[model samples]
Target: MTPHELETILTEIGLSNSALARHVNRSEGNVRQWRKGVSKIPDDVAEWLREYHYFFQKNPPPQRKG
Candidate 1:
């Protein structure tokens, strides 16, 4: 996926760079690079995002009890 598309997915999933980095097993700086177009989105990361989008659509996560 393109950087713009990744950014859109991140927004849709309500995750910031820090959260997405953790989910994808990457560093926040890496996510920032992808978001800013300083580096391309890795193929695996794109696929993970796609899968996450699909899964989240089908099964939204439960809210945290605070």
Candidate 2:
């Protein structure tokens, strides 16, 4: 996905760059670079985010969905 799209997803998930970095095991600088458009997200990272989006949409955490 595009950087903006990723950013939107991050926002929807209520995570900052640091939180997302922790979730994905990436560096905070990498997340910041992606957000700043200074770097592109790797395919694996994109896939991870897509999976997360799907999981949450289809089977969100009980508290969040409920």
Candidate 3:
């Protein structure tokens, strides 16, 4: 995916770079690179992000107890 698309998806999912990195089993730096267009986003990661975005839209996460 293009960096712009990746950034948009991440925003839609409401996930920080660190959170995405954890979910995708990658380093935060890797996610940063993808977001910045410094590195290519793998096809698998892009696919997973798209799926996650859909899930996030349909079933937003529950609020944390405080």
Candidate 4:
């Protein structure tokens, strides 16, 4: 995905760059580079984020039945 798309997804998930970096096991500066479009986000990293998005969307938390 493009940097803008990646940034948008992260924002939608309420994840900061530092958080993403920690999850992806990369340095915060690496995330910043991706956000700034200095370098492409690696395929593995992108896949990791996509998987997280899919998991959350597919299996949402159970709701209280009031």
Give the TM-scores of the predictions, in the order they appear.
0.83, 0.82, 0.84, 0.83
Candidates' C-alpha lDDT? 0.90, 0.86, 0.92, 0.89
10 residues in a row with least lDDT, candidate 3: 6-15
Best by TM-score: 3
| Top of the candidates by lDDT | 3
Regions of candidate 1 where Cα sits further than 4 Å from its true position:
61-66
Tell me how candidate 2 scores on lDDT: 0.86
The predicted structure with the larger lDDT, 2 or 4, is: 4
Which digits, one per residue and each the tens of the lDDT, describe model 4 over residues 1-66?
A: 789989888976778989999999999999999999999999999998888878877886687998
Instruction: Give residue 14's lDDT in candidate 4 (0 to 100).
Output: 74
User: What TM-score should be assigned to candidate 3?
Assistant: 0.84
Per residue, candidate 2 scores C-alpha lDDT tens digits across 1-66 of 788989888877678888889988999999999988899999898998988877777876667553
lDDT of 4: 0.89
Kindly report which residue stretches of model 4 are placed more than 4 angstroms away from their true locations once superposed. Answer: 60-66
Better candidate number, 2 or 3, judged by lDDT: 3
